[model samples]
Target: MQQVVIIGAGMGGLAAALRLQAHGFDVTVLEKQPRPGGRSSVIEECGFRVDTGPTILVMKDAFEDTYRAIGENLNERVEFVRLDPNYRIYYHDDTHLDLYSDPAKLAEEVERVAPGSGAQLARFMADSAAKYALGMAFVERNYTQITDLANPVALRRLLQTRAYQNLYRQVARAFGGSDKLAKAFSFHSMFLGLSPFEALAMYSLITYADLALGMWYPLGGIYRIVEDMLHLAQQMGVTVRTNAPVEQICIEAGRVRGVRLASGEEVPADIVVSNADLPYTYRHLVAPEHRRSYPDARLERMDYACSGYLLYLGVDRTYPHLQHQALYFSEDYRANLDAIFRTRTLPDAPSFHLNVPTVTDPSLAPPGHSLLYVLAPMPNLTAGIDWEAAAPVVREKLLAQLERIVDPDIREHIVWERDYRPTDFLHDFNAAHGTAFGSLSHGFFQSAYFRPHNKAPDVDGLYFVGQGTYPGIGLPMVHISSRLVTERILEEWS
Candidate 1:
């Protein structure tokens, strides 16, 4: 049997282990944290269990595919609840719009926001559906060379959909120049840590995937999927070790030997797959001589995704009126985005995502209580903003917004509270630049074939999986990445 060692037991790592083990390889998963699930981990306090990252789940087919690859059924293991009116968009002028998965209901809501724009939305979705189909053709496969991505058929589809254009411009034009509708639709790109104004129109596929494919929530939380995968991997004879931080990837004669753990233990393997942040893996784990392809200079020059200020609160009372997911857009959406992406400064009025999972699963919190998870996109550590000082200020601003929008005196009902900052991301996950989303941003040059390949270019027997590699960012994309890397490994090593 071929021996395989995977670093960081994240969603990508755990899923890959299951697939590789099913193929008769000896797989071992080492996690730095005490628990599995890197960003998708959980936070428990005062009888409230909250997911630390990725509250919304879309493109569930990707997840189902992962399970089917291992000869298991996803629905049989994890319970999924579809969310209606996926997101409630709260605007600056005290107006709100609900995004629904049902086409007829969505059309009604779009018409409510921008009259006579229902037809325009239908057109936009048609284009979005095309983009999704075309984009997934590239996303679901492996890329060995640039020609694999820029071939004749792909180029023709790219031109046909005009997916190379700017995302915000396309949405704005499709909505007949309605800024509200444009922002509401294009904001999906922000999850990838790119401003819609700057991201490519191909990203509108995210909006289509969310609305058309529908937004789903696993009953226990997003972490429940992680738990299930970990359980299955262990049952399949994959050894999982927590609190095992890898200090270095040992390479000799241009080939990976194994990995050195923080405790001075070395584990040997025929191959090593890293689920760590790509830049961090290159910079910190691989020695200087072994990483000619990704020198420190090139890593520094790479664009990283924005970080986030996360506030988790377990309140003593529940607000039944709040939806499972909601978003608050600042009056100056452009300025708000500029503050994070361009200027790398704090916004005067920050936009935020609010999630009250107790609305969907009250069991997450104590009886009759609620759990609130607030995330505001902020500049990554490159901005040099002192999070120790900025966290309190950001928390106050978010609470103030919550008080005004959701419930009055919201702060008073808090029984437990905790916050995570950019520094925490750096410390906990060793994420380069303390990026909260994927470490690498999804710029035009940093996507698809342009992104780092799953197999290492310099070192033999070293590979990468997760958001930092191709098919970048988001839970669904990470699941796809796992399969891509697993296939690559099997083809080469099996």
Candidate 2:
């Protein structure tokens, strides 16, 4: 078997190890952190379990594909409980719009909200579904070199996908004047760190993924998926060594041979796949001469996804009316987005995503208690905001923001609380400039064929996976990225 060394035991790295191991590669996963799962990790504090990041689940088929490829079935291992109302969007005035999984019920709700909106929603769903299908196919086809996509037909199809139009414009065209409908559909773009007005219309496929595949959650928590994937990787005989930070990718001539750990120990392999942040890998892991094409000058010009300021709270009391998922939008959504993306500062009134697991799975908390993850999209550290000064203020602001939209007496009911700022993401993940979700802005130059390469430009036999590369951010896309890279590795060794 060809030896494959995967750097980083993140979701992408773990998934890649599973796929490549099945393809008969001897895989060894090296994680710098003591634990696996990367962002979807769990922390226990004061006898309360806190899941710090990545709350909701979407694109169920991706997990199914991963297991099936390994001669196993995902549903057989983990039961995915389909969430009926995918996410309940709580408006500023305390009223809500439930974005449901069932199309008929969703349309019924649409009709209730705006006359004749059901028909518009139908058309919108149909178009979004097509985009999702086409997007997946095109996204998976590797453009290892930008010139690989010079074919005119591929170019035309790419343009036709509205990779050019802004997501907000597309939503406004379909759901005009209905602010609630527009906000509900365009909200996921926040994951990409783009305001609906700035993010690509191609992201409209988020609608299809949420409504069609159905919103879901593992029985325990999002972190359970990580544990499951880790279990599967280990079962396949892949050795995952944690707290093994790689100092550099040792390149001989023009190809990658292996990596040197920070401890001065060398772990050699025939091939190396980096699940690290792409920009960080280019800057730190690889030497300066090897980075001829992917230079800091060009990288500086690229738009980075926003970082997150998160608070993981273990509440002492139950929020009976809260759902599993909710978006607490402060008034002036556009201005708030502008403050984060454009101004690169905390907004006067920021919209936050809240995950109340107790509402859906009471087992996550002690009886009559809750767990909440409050996340806000802010510009990466590139904006140069003073996080030390802002972390506490932001945390308090999020609590206040949650109070306005959800529970009025939120602080009084708090059992335990911990907050994460951009600094934490940078320090922990080596995330470039504390960027939250990696390379996700869907700007003109940031599109697929233009995003970070799966294969390193300078070093041979060095490939990339996860949020920074093609197929982009979110759990499902990263899973697909792992699949694509493993296929390439299989072909290369064969």
- lDDT tens string, model 2, 1-494? 67789988878888888888998889999899988887777887765666777877888778678878889888888867888888888777767788888998899888877778998898888878867865775676677676765666645655766645788878877886688788888887887667787877877878788888888978778787788888888788999999999989999999988899999999888899999888888888998888899888877777788888888888788867778888877778888888888887778877888888777677777777788888888778888889889888888888887777667898888888888888888887788788887755656566678877788767778999888887788788888888888777766668
**Residue 432, model 2, lDDT:** 79
Which runs in model 1 stand beyond 4 Å of their true positions? none
Extract clashing residue pairs from model 2. Answer: 307-436
TM-score of candidate 2 against the unseen true structure = 0.95
Evaluated against the true structure, the overall lDDT of model 1 is: 0.92
lDDT of each: 0.92, 0.81
C-alpha RMSD values across all candidates: 0.9, 1.9
Model 2: how far residue 450 lies from native, Å: 1.7
TM-score of 1: 0.99
| Cα lDDT tens digits for candidate 1, 361-400 | 9999999899999999999999999888898899999999
Candidate 1 local Cα displacement, residue 472, angstroms: 1.1
